[model samples]
Every structure is written in structure tokens, then in C-alpha cells.
Target: VLVCLILRLSGNVGAAPESALITSLPGFSGAFPSKHYSGYVTIDGKPSPKNLFYYFVSSERNPQLDPVVLWLNGGPGCSSFDGFVYEHGPFNFEVGNSTGTLPVLHLNPYSWSKVSSVIYLDSPAGVGFSYSENTSNYVNGDFQTASDTHTFLLKWFELFPEFVANPFYIAGESYAGIYVPTLASDVALGTKTGAKPIINFKGYMVGNGVSDPKFDGNALVPFAHGMALISDSMFEEAEAACNGNYHEPKDQKCSNILDEIDEALSGLNIYDILEPCFYGSAAKDDERKNTSSLPLSFKQLGATDKPFPVRKRIFGRAWPFHAPVRDGIVPSWPELVKRSGLSVPCMDNTLATIWLNNEAVRKAIHASPEAGEWTLCIDIAYTHDAGSMIKYHLNLTAQGYRALIF
Candidate 1:
């Protein structure tokens, strides 16, 4: 559910031993073999006023020998706990019969922490329990975030300085596509300039990410077209009307075509494109029943002129207006809906949200007194700086960093 870029370290590092240990975690039925640590590290910004919260999990196998991975969830504002709970963390929220109380946690078999020691960080000062005593720091940008996060790594090592010499990797998903490389660039450059607590920075691991805003936006139409989600006419109209630009279409028709694309995909769980959500992870029964209540276009909202396709039989049950038209046509009238009704398979960030907002959970994680609520993503007023990461990737490769995208 998260787009990630991994910075894989190639060699070993040497550091003095120290004790930064985890006593226990709530909800695990038994003892955990690995140590866990959660705390806040004050970053050097505004001459002083800031902190970034983190959850560090040591490998179950070999903590000393295993490389350290700094995993970041990209929302430019989202909490890394989303990654911790949903993606690759050591534990996850349990299934619920209802959304009435705090969700319990369960150990994960496929956690990345099973092999490598991982640090899940809430970054950019304003995310998760990370905060700034001076609110002005909340309005940040790519370099500013990287700069502070780099300082955070240095200071974090000061706390568990034993791992300072461990191979360090930076991985981020989504906007962290923006965040990861930017941070990697900072670490690489800082090391070159002889920055203190020298980090054994390594390479990148990511899926295709947003490198160039323009290309990222422009590529959507072609991708949708390739997927047969949009009509050729719609694609042609989008290309012609906006002059091959859809990021912020100036022409009205292009906007209409873009809206059509949205309408086509509205019924799908974008993260897991194969599934149509019968109910959102957090949606109650009444909410599930109200899936049909979402407003639609005049034609889709109103009655249609085309004759209904012949109903099909499944186990002798006649099913009419079934979902998922092969021609990429709109869903049946009953299937017409919006985001609230959607849920991704094997993903429930909503569950993470429910758990983190609990008072006890915050206390357990040593959450900041300043941060009011824990959320999957944060919407901060970050200044957009890098238009693309092409230059950054080229630079890293030139500096001898290997790159992998899955």
C-alpha cells in the first residue's frame, strides 16, 4: 500500500556499544525476542526547536550484524506508523468485529524487522509525535526535511551510538519518492564534506516514483489508456484539449476528460486495483448500505438510455448489472460510488488510525504532548522545490550508489 525506495548499504561500519532497549510492547500475547525502542530525537533546526518521533525495531536474528534501514512513509505529511502497522512493520492491528474500541495488535510473520533492524520515523517536525516548539518550522520543503532528518540520524546515533557504524539505508514511499532521494543526497554530500558521525550511506530501492511532476502527471493518461480504463476518444480529447498536459488542465474539455477518468476508477481500490470494496475497513453497516447514496453525473446519476445487458446466473442466482464491465464502461447503477466505500485487500490504514489515536497507545509509544492526533498522513504547507529527481538519481549513481526499483 506504500511506495518505497530502499537505500541498501554495501558494507559494515564500526561504532561504540550502547544500550537503547525496549522493555515490552502492548498486545503481543508472548515475549518478543527482539528489542524495541520508541522515542523522540530533537533535530538541529531553528537553532534548536524541533523533534522527530521514531519506532526502532532490532532484527530477531542478528541486531549487531544486520544493516539498519530508515523507513519513511511518504505523505509529505503522513505518519510512519502507517508503514509500521500496515506495510512492513513487526506487528499489525488485528481484525475487528466492530470499530467500537482500540484495536489489538498481533505479531507479523513477514515483518522487515525479522531480518534487518529498522527505524520507522515520523518526519518533517509536524508529522506524528514529531513537533516543533516554533510552529514556523511546520512550513517546510524537500531540502529542509532532508536536512533535519539527516541531523536526526546523527543525533539518533548519539542515543544508540552503537549502531552509528552500522550500514545505513534510507527508504521512503510516495512523496518519500521525493523525500528518499533528497535525504540520500544530503547524507551523501554531508559525508563528502566530513559531517560528524559519518553515515555509511548506501543505495536506493524503490518502485517507479514521482520524479518529475510534469512527467508524472502526463504519464497518467497513457497509463490509463494502456490499461483500457479510458476510451480512446477520451484519451485523444485529453491529449488534444490540454495539449498533452493534464496536471492542471486549462481547457474545459480536458478537465471533463480527466473527470471521466476519475469516474471510471472511482469504484476501484486504487492500491489494489483488482478489488471493488464492498465496504471501507472502518465503515459500519449503515455506511455500507449507503454506498448507493453517493451523487453522480446527470446521466449516471439519472436513468440510462442503453438497454441492460442480459443478466448472468451464478449458482442459479440471476445477477443483473454486475460490476466490472470488460469494456471499461461504468459500473452498474448500484455499483456507482466514491472513496468512503472502498477498501484495499490486506490493507486497513483505518485500523492503524483507530489504534494510534488511543490514549494508551500514544503513552506506550512515548508520543509527544504537543502532537494532538495520530493520522495516516499529514497535510502540511510544504514548499515544493524539486520539480524532478532525475538529476538526483544521476548524481547518486555517479557517486557510486546502486539503485533498485521494484
Candidate 2:
């Protein structure tokens, strides 16, 4: 019945309120060479817009027609259904700590949906199950999340009008690297399609992106000594005391590189300083039997608490949370802003939740007047190594996009 209520709310859908739940998932039968669907996408007039859950894989026995990607995950309140059930998905979720039946994981031949048609969006407006009976329009930024993802891709290309001129792309990672280049430059500048062209945007991808918070603290002192998580003489004395300054005195070389990366990451264990390198391309006995039959660290991914005292009580009034509150002596920002009367301005809520003062992302797309042409890829070795892993390849070349950086 409605695909058993969308595979039982796609396995226990949390963060509730999809208009008091009713999924309706049926319709995936037969000569199956691809055809999947699950619903919800209702967002008209901002006030109480909810019901935005989606899944629509399609190939219907390929004839070379795919390319649709659109994913977004960054916790400007997280949930791109964990990039479709855990990175490059094709279905994955097997949690049942006290059960007798769990297995349901499928497809993984480098599953970027076997060549694209992904979508997975649970966005701006109280995240998962996407609500918003006006929780103050879910306090969004980045131009109301690129105008509610351009009205959810013009009602998902008016409910799949045979892929309305397919060739779309928009991937994500780390605050979706500022939500896929500000919603792929507002869906490649198309908003009033009365003259046709609502979207065919064929370019965008981001991984480990936080695109220029002034080069994100210029790659945290060489990615804290190439992920050994600090040392190499405290990343060469915080790269010679924040060398050519990074705006604002940044409180003395960010307080001596947060006191020598908190004395070399005290009690060293941010899941052994962020694991996941499952034997870079396998083989030491098949990467120790696939990191001992997976559950690859970061305290098996549940992240065994104490993430720097919960990011020092959630970014204790920034300035990079004053070196984890002066290495845990806590209380500083003008003595916790005169003992929590909370007079805001922690650099205007960290530059308006990282939209970094969005005047359409502070101009400069070569000063857009619909600045047609554009191309730029700043990789600096995955922006100074966090065990470097950035591989991009943009298309549409003849003078619009041609990015590439290994």
C-alpha cells in the first residue's frame, strides 16, 4: 500500500512531521533495470511548508540518458538522508542492535547512483522531514537557502517531465561547501522562465568545502600537521604565528595555535583523530580485512562524545572558540559575555551562520550583472592536505566551466 508506506518510512523516519506522516511508496515492479520512487515535495509560500522527502532512482533500462546528482548535506542542520544512507548511496542502513534481522544494504559499485540521478534533499526549514510552520522561517541564510533550492528545482522539474532537459548537477560536502556554490549560481541564473530556461545547470561538486572563510583559517595550520593532528613543531609554530595575518589580530596566532593544538590534542582520540582512510585503496591484508569488517572508527562512528567539550560548549563565542576555551580552563569571551546575558554579536552569529554576509555572497563573481562566463578551481593540494582527497572534474568547456584538480 503506497509501497508499504514508502518502505516503512524509509526505515523509521525520525525528526517527524511530514504533514503528520503518510509516505505512500508503491510502484517499483518488474523487468527492473532501474525504477524507484518515494515521495513528498510540498513547499508553496514559506509559512508552513513541510513534506519534502524524496527518492527517485531511474534508468528504466538505460539508453545513455542519466546525469542528475543534486545532493546536499551540511547541518546548516544536517540530513541529505546521510547522503542517501551513507555516502554515495544505493541503499544502506542496517542497524538493529537487539534484533534477528537487519541486512538490506545493496549496490556499491562506487554508487554515485551508478552514474547519477540522486537528489536526496532534506533542507533549510528544520531539516529532516523538512518542516516549517514558521519556526521563524527556520532561520535560514544564504539567501533563504538559494531561494528554497529554487523552489525545489521548479517542483522537481514539474514532477519529472521526462527529466526536463536533463544535465543537472549539484553535489555536497561540508556545509555543502556553502550549499553547492550558492545553489550553482542560482541554477545558472534562471528564475523567471517565461522565456524558457528554468534549469539545465550542468556543473557543480564539492567535498571538504567551506569555500573561503578566508581560505578557512588557511587550512588549519597545515591541516594540523597533515592529520597527525598536530606537531611538526606545532605546525611550525602555527605557521610562524599566522604569518601574513588572516584578518583581525586573530588573537595572537590564534592563541599560539590553540596552545600547540591543545598540547597535541590532549587525550588524543577524536576517534583516533578522525579515522577513515580505510587503507588508502586497500591491501594490507585487504586493509586488515576491511578495517576488521567495517565500523571504521571515530569510535565506530557514534563519535564517543567529548568532541572537545562539545566544541567548547558550542563555539563559546567564537574567535575559533578561543582555543577550546583556553585549553579547557573554559570561560573567556569577555568572561562568557559578562556571564551569559548573551548580547549576540559573536561576529554577527559567525557571519550569519557562515553565509558570510551574503549580499548574494558578497558580490564578486567577477561582479555579476548576470556575469555570464565563469571558471575557477582553487585546490592548493586539497587546500593544504588533510591527507588530501579532492578530485573534481567539471564539464561544459568551450568557455564556461572546465575545472579539474586531482
Would you list the C-alpha lDDT of every candidate in the order shown? Answer: 0.64, 0.46
Clashing pairs in 1: 3-173, 5-205, 6-205, 7-203, 77-378, 78-377, 78-378
Candidate 1, 110-191: lDDT as tens digits: 8998888899999888788788778777878887888888888888776775566667788867667788888899889888
Candidate 2: C-alpha RMSD after superposition: 20.9
Local distance difference test, candidate 2: 0.46
In lDDT terms, which candidate is top? 1
Instruction: Name the runs in model 2 displaced over 4 angstroms.
Output: 1-69, 72-82, 88-90, 93-171, 174-179, 182-184, 192-208, 217-219, 222-228, 231-236, 241-406
Best by TM-score: 1
Query: Which 10 successive residues of model 2 have the least lDDT summed?
Result: 375-384
Candidate 1 matches the true fold with a TM-score of 0.78
TM-score, model 2 to reference: 0.30
